[model samples]
Target: MDAFNLAKQRYADLGVDVEKSLQTLAATPVSLQCWQGDDVGGFENAGGALTGGIAATGNYPGKARGPAELRADLDLALSLIPGSHRVNVHASYAELGGQKVDRDAYTIEHFAGWVDWAKQRGLGLDFNPTCFSHPLSADGFTLSHHDEAVRKFWIRHGIACRKIAGEMGRRLGKTVITNFWMPDGFKDTPVNRRAYRERMEQSLDEIFAVAIDQQCNRDALESKLFGVGFESCTIGSHEFYMGYTMKNKKVLCLDAGHFHPTETLADKISSVLQFLPEILLHVSRGVRWDSDHVVALDDQTRALMEEIVRGDYLSRVHIGMDFFDASINRIMAWVIGARNTQKALLLALIEPRDRLRKLEAEGDYSTRLALLEEAKSLPFGAIWDEFCRRNNTPVGVAWIPTVKDYEKKVLSARK
Candidate 1:
């Protein structure tokens, strides 16, 4: 309490309203991707290779065995993280009760239990079509496959996913963001990459021909620069999606780790928003390439959130997280990444923007730089602690013991 008092006064001196920052930060919902809990291994089948150039290294024990365990793990992770949030679910995680149903045939019945679970917890849900890690994607292509039959199969899967997402939104009274990402690229330089892009454009057109309830769901297509086997080319490149999204007026999904490590999503957010009404933002960290490491409170995340808040684009930017780290405790990874994301947003919301902007507009770069650096050294930890208390979440390391206790009681027995 004393620390918070001091921090509040310190920020108030800079014309920063700490209370409004806390409120804005609290209202921001970061969707926790389901893949993190299961290491990109959904509940569709017992075991299969990660075929989409997706890799989750490390063999940490106590991985979720099924939906029940995954849900329990998510429940525990949410309790530790402050703020209301949403869950991002992939098509592969459908609960079909041991019945074999192809991806093209999935229905809302398979995910009805998830909706019920989310309703009970007051959590919103997001959807994604798993266009990788299946036999159809074994050739490193799905929607962009050369074979007509293969393209149709994946196209059907996309259509089904959109409908299911719409139902989830209607039932939950929240708009579900159904994002599409595929591993459609070549390991080696191909004779013709344009042919595949043409095929993919046709396939996407067919899949999106039938519209779902717009009020219930929003469609987003993601792009990738390159992957392990896809070193030379990626069909759904940023340029491709940008053209398609701009033409169709659909939400473009931008994954932080999906681009060249040099390119940052922070730069693309404002530019894309000028043409599109909104965007679906996926948060992740890449060590060198698109490694999908756990997200940290680094400059990338801080700058991305800062851009959104600075532009007043929070309502237009839908934020979600993507990364799977099997190395550490799965629950701990989620807690760390989610909490860091929220903390970054808090930093952004509490920024002394009015003063900084005034200085920038007047070309007072010297004072602007000084204030920016000084803002960093402010008592942010105290403000974060106070925000955690306001949300009734455990403040600081107090939640660490709870994770340890859960690991011992629940995770240790999973083996």
Candidate 2:
């Protein structure tokens, strides 16, 4: 209590409200991706390898084999992390009843259990249409496939997934964001690129043709530069999605790891918000390509959150995780990634924005640079430690032993 008071007074001296920051942080929700639990292997029982430029590297023991186990693992993770949050589900993670069902024919009934689970836990939900690792998308193209049959198949899948998202929001009494990301591209440079993009434009129009109330479900389209097999060209490039979003007044998803090596999502947040009403961010780390490495409290991560806070776009920018690393304990991976995201946001919230903004506006570059560098060494760790105590989460590295115990008592029993 004494240390926390000192830190609070220190922040107060800088004209930053630490209590307000914690309150705002508590209200903000980070959607945790479910794919990390099972390494993108959903409950369809599709005994096939992941295709379309997506791959999970490790063969970690005790991977969630079904919906129930996955939910339990998520519960453990949620317990360790502070603040309210949501779960991001892929269409592939449906609760099929041992009966074979295709992605296109999916319905809200398949996800009833998930809704109940989330509702019980007082958590919000987000969804994505899984368009890869299936027969129709075997050729590395889905929404932009050259074949009419393949294109329509993916279109139906998108439409169905949107409706499911609507139902989730309707029942939970909160708007659910259904994001669309397809691995539609070419392994080699195609003779004609416009043809594929044209098909994609038409397919997206058809999928969004049915009027679903925005209050129930909001639509977001994601773009990518390249994937494992589709290195030559990606149909849904950032330019394409930005244009579509502006015209349609829908959310444009900017994935952290989906862009070129040199580009960062931080610099694009304000620019995108200028044109679009809202934006969704898939927070992941890319080593060289879109590797989906677990996120850390790095400089890039801090910059991303700082941009959001400084721009006052917290409400407009939705934050969600999109990485999957099977090398570590999956539960700990979720905790680490989620905590780091929250930490970054906390650090951003604690910044003396008014002072910096005034300096920038008045052209006091020297003082601004000095203060910015000085802030890096502030007592942020003390506030973060107090935040964990307030939220009843484990402080610092204390949560690690809990995860290891769970691995021994639960995960190890799976095999």
Candidate 3:
């Protein structure tokens, strides 16, 4: 069949109305993690650690020069990707001697400025704390560390930035979202490991306290219109995993690829969801034991994808493509990654659940297991085609399509 007619027939078979599916897809917002001047040669001068012994210099090409240039680039990128507004800013500096030392000031002011700028453009900000600057945080930012002064400094800086973000939201009529990921683990036996976890929580408490204060301040100013949204992620092995702390917070931003090299992705997702039903997912692809390549999903990663679809957390979910690619055009990488992730998520939502049910009824784990395997290996193009085709109707596009569509086609159809 021709591509268009094949698409049409697929829609008919899935009992989906085309127009409604498009609307549904359009409604799903795809957020991105972008550097300030990733395009227009601006990333060249930002000044940071070199990767793989290569000096980090002006690698990106575009019109951006400084902060304003970077901000403009982000604005343009968001414009091209519809329903995408959130940008994760990577704040880093090598030294406090010159312009690099003043990065704290620049970062604070630039982010606050961007928050204002994003308001004008109707976008959101996702601020990630300092991680790239290894010299400053060589010992990591855990509470158990002996660097009391440095730890205090980190807390003060975080509070200051968040306060500025909160104030900007009040003035600009937008929301400021924050995500915290602490590098606080050890490879060897720690002298005082328990002390470290406690300290980390203590630091987090201080940060959370500031957030609560900022939320109140924002709430009081605008009648609770522009409140702060707090999220945190950690490597899966943290002493007190993110889900444990997220109970008091709004949501945990689960990094699907951050679990240990040998850990099962699906088990991690199931565990986190069981603990915290509402989550903000950070999607990236990598082997269980290798570096983050930022490639699309493989078989192992799909296990988590399946749980995300079958669970009840899709609506509250916000998707972000988190990866590093210095050689490729940064904006294009983001755009392509976002598009591919959209396809993956939609496929997970549409996979036939009746097959899963039959496998359960017959105590046949193999078919259900194979279904997840198949779901993961399905090509991105095929997934998007199927999603668009199956979601072609208003009824097919109803509330929480995954759950509802599963009920209509699989559950009701069986009856």
Candidate 4:
């Protein structure tokens, strides 16, 4: 028998259907972040270094300088990755045609090109408000600024982005999830913490009050424990967004790298779903800090996927990539991160959870533990290769040559 056939029988013995797992993985969509191609440096003329307590290291060659090149890179990356997916965009990445437009003034016209592109590919679109890397946000505040005018400016931007997202969804025939993640916090200890949070609360309310149809656009708030400069305190802490999401009945985004090193975001999935209707997950690799690194098929990623599948919360959870690594080939980084994410999900889908649950019910902890370890040794690689073959994507290291060739032909032309 072929390797995949043998592995299929092995999984069948454990009461897991291999074909059903593949079908599930094929249907689930992972929203690919647009910033990865340009290292969070959007094509906006509002030029400045990366701010809002974030940085993408390394000066890799062939970085996408404009919308056309970014789209081209994405086309290649998407071709290599298996399964259909969505593309996530930040407001700063709008195609303005050299026209000067500030954040608050942004409209769907700026992103009509993106909507057109997604429509052609039958892909869904997601959006963010781009609350960092601007003169107004240089003081480390956007939505929660001490200045009421500054807060109002950001609030308008948020409302405008939501309208654009609605249009994107309506045009594409898929719901576009708009995630609001602002880098508003203090570098030092603040004498008044509640005041800033209160301001943030009011700002969020004003932004969300201008609601469009949920089918066209849904809202989500992402929280961060701390960033590089804002180490002392983050106004949008986990507890803050938790309360806000629960009360407002909005989707909550749980970034894997946004919490402390000891806190696994996988643990928060089941807990948050109790109150909120759904969740938006930011799948990123944080090395010590929120140092957005390329994702690999590691234990953390596996555990995260396992939790979603085991709890039967796949439909309720929206998965999206949130890492950027300029240290490597930008295209390669995108492929590696995205492919690993899907691979981890495939592993999670193929897991014999029913047997494990039954073993747990019977208090066969020792057998359950032994079987879990043994299951990991199965020929999962064969199944994964077969999946790639079925999807017409390159198997194993076969895709690497395509990236290198693209780098030589397309990337090398960029200077």
Candidate 5:
């Protein structure tokens, strides 16, 4: 407490309100990805390999096999994470009865169990339309496929997901962000990229034809540079989605791992906010490509959050986790990625943005640079520790042993 108090005074001298930063961070919610627990394997009972750009590379034992087990594991992860939070669910993760239910035909009844589970924990929910890992999408063309039947199949699935998301949000009294990302492209350079993008645009329009209230469900469109097999041409490229999102006034999801290796989203947030009302961010780490590695407190992430806070666009941005690392303890992976995300946001929030901006506006570049470098040495760890302590979550390494104990008792016993 004494250390935190001293750190608070130091930041206060720079015109940064430490209490306001903590309050704002506590109110912010970071959405957790559910696929990290079971390596993108959902409860659909669909015995098929993960196709599309998705692949969780690890044979870690004690993976959750069903909804009950997955929820139990999530419960433990959320307990360790500080601040308000929500869970992001892919359509494939729906908890349905033993009977087979196709994706296009799915309804909210299939996910009522998930809503009830979230309600019990006072956690909000976000959703995704799973457009991969099914026979319909096995050809690596869905929504953008030339075949009308194939395109319509994925189109219906997307529409159904929007309806489900609306209901989930209505029940929870929070807007559920339904994001659409498809693995539709060609392995080799296609002669007709226009046709595929045209089909995709049409499909998206039809899926969003039904007007769900923005308060009930918000929509996001995600784009990718390339994927595993479709390295030559990705139909839904960044330019395509950016143009579409601007025209339609929908949220554009800028995933950290979805761009070129050298590019960072910190440079794009303010650019998009100029036209789009709001945007969604999928925080992930990419190794050369979109490998979906666990997120860390790296420079790219810190810069991204700094842009959001410095631009005062935090309220206009919805942040969600998109990485899935199956190589380590899944529960621990969740805690590490989520906590680091919170840490990055806190680091950005604690910056003396007003003073920095004043210096920059006054043409005092040298002093701005000096202050920025000096601020990097500030006691951010103390503020973070105090945040965790106030949230009643385990501070630092204290939560790690709980995960190990859960693995030994609950996870190991799984056959």
Candidate 6:
């Protein structure tokens, strides 16, 4: 069957009303990180500091665009995909010399402006504060004890940004989701690294406390009925603060690709869901060595993964694509990545829980594998076609020409 029919049949079998399903689907917050081009040559060229080789090769088609152009490109690309409403802007101001410099003011203004622009388009913003700009963070944010100053600096920065973010949310009626990805762990002295982690949690407690106070104030305003709520979703390489905070204020954002190779993704999802049922997700794919490959979702794996994600806690789920591509046309990469990830999520949502449960109860690896194989067999193109048919909406498609194609086109035009 086509995707729309499949979705309908699955929903019927699962006893989910189609109208309610569509409403839930429509309400789902889909976002993408704006810093993908930070390390690559792009519109916001920081004197080539963030450009990793694409610009050097002279193949950077998007290097000349500014922040306005980048935002426009994102707007156009997102309009092509279905169910994409949120865009995460990476507001790492450490490039401006931390809190001690005047650059922090400029960075905050830049982000506030972007947040306002996105609000006009009815999109939400997810903020990742400055964490990856210095060698002091080579160990990780919230995980480095040796650099007490760096930790303290981040705490201050977090508090300041929380205020700015809270103000922006109040003005725009959107929640500012702050994501914390601490690169705090040890490669050699794993035992000694425990102290570093402890300090990290302490720092996080302070940050989370501040975020809660700011959000409570924002959530209390009656005249400003924007329905926005602030959340500090912590993404870590390890479960350092699994059950540390109360519900709704601080939550864990599981990065599906961040787990070790030995740990099953399904098991990891189940463990986190069991402890904290309502959580956010930073979705991506990787192989043995690479952690973020930006590859197409593996059908069988994603089906089972989605089953876990759609349990009692699906409403609390916020989706964002975390991938790094050094290509020049970062906009096109973001567009394709977002579209593919959304398709994967839709399929997972439509799959029946009982069917999956039966396969799991069989206790045979092949039986579970077969179920996933069936889930993966659902053709994405067919599904897209069906979605358009059922919704009576024309598909918005973009033709992002590759580097070679662009080169040939540009040269031919010059002649």
Could you give candidate 3's per-residue lDDT for residues 258-340 as a string of tens digits? 55556565665566556654556667665433233454745544555557666645664555656655455454455556555
Candidate 5's TM-score reads 0.99
Worst 10 residues of 1 by lDDT: 44-53
TM-score of each: 0.99, 0.99, 0.69, 0.98, 0.99, 0.73
Kindly give the stretch of ten consecutive residues in candidate 4 with the minimal lDDT sum.
39-48
Give the whole-model CA lDDT for all candidates, comma-separated.
Answer: 0.92, 0.92, 0.49, 0.91, 0.93, 0.52
Which portions of model 5 show Cα errors greater than 4 Å? Answer: none
Clashing residue pairs found in predicted model 2: none
Q: lDDT, candidate 6, residue 76?
A: 58
Candidate 2 regions with alpha-carbon error over 4 angstroms: none
**Which pairs in model 4 have colliding backbones?**
none
The sequence of per-residue lDDT tens digits that candidate 1 reaches over residues 1-415 is 9999899999999999999888888888999998898898898876667878888899999999899999999999999899989999999999999899999999999999899999999999999999988888888989888898999999999999999999999999999999998889888898898899999999999988988989999899999889889999999999999999999989999999988778878999999999999999889999988888888999999999999999999999999999999999999999999999999999998899999999999999999999999999999999999989988899999999999999999999997
Per-residue alpha-carbon lDDT of candidate 2 for residues 207-293, written as tens digits (9 for 90 to 100): 999888899899999999999989999999999999998998889999999999899789999999998889999889999889999
Per-residue C-alpha lDDT of model 5 across residues 334-398, encoded as one tens digit per residue: 99999999999999999999999999999999999999999999998899999999999998799
Candidate 6 runs further than 4 Å off: 1-23, 38-45, 48-60, 63-65, 93-108, 135-143, 185-187, 211-237, 243-249, 354-381, 388-415
Model 5 clash pairs? none
Q: Which is better, 2 or 4, measured by lDDT?
A: 2
List, residue by residue over 1-415, the lDDT tens digit for candidate 4: 2999999998998899999999999899999999999889997863359899998899889889888899999999998899879999999998888888898999999998999999999999999999999889999998889999999999999999999999899989999999999898889999899999999999999999996999999999999989879999899999999999999999999998899999978888999887777999999989998888888899999999999999999999999999999888999998999899999999998889999999999999999999899989888998888888888999999999999999999888876
How far residue 238's Cα lies from its native spot in candidate 2, in Å, is 0.8
The residue-level lDDT of candidate 5 at 18 comes to 98
Per-residue CA lDDT of candidate 6, range 208-277, in tens?
6664344422211000001011011222334454544323335566565555555555555556666554
TM accuracy, model 1: 0.99
Clashes of 6: 4
RMSD for all candidates, in order, please: 0.9, 0.9, 12.2, 1.0, 0.9, 8.1
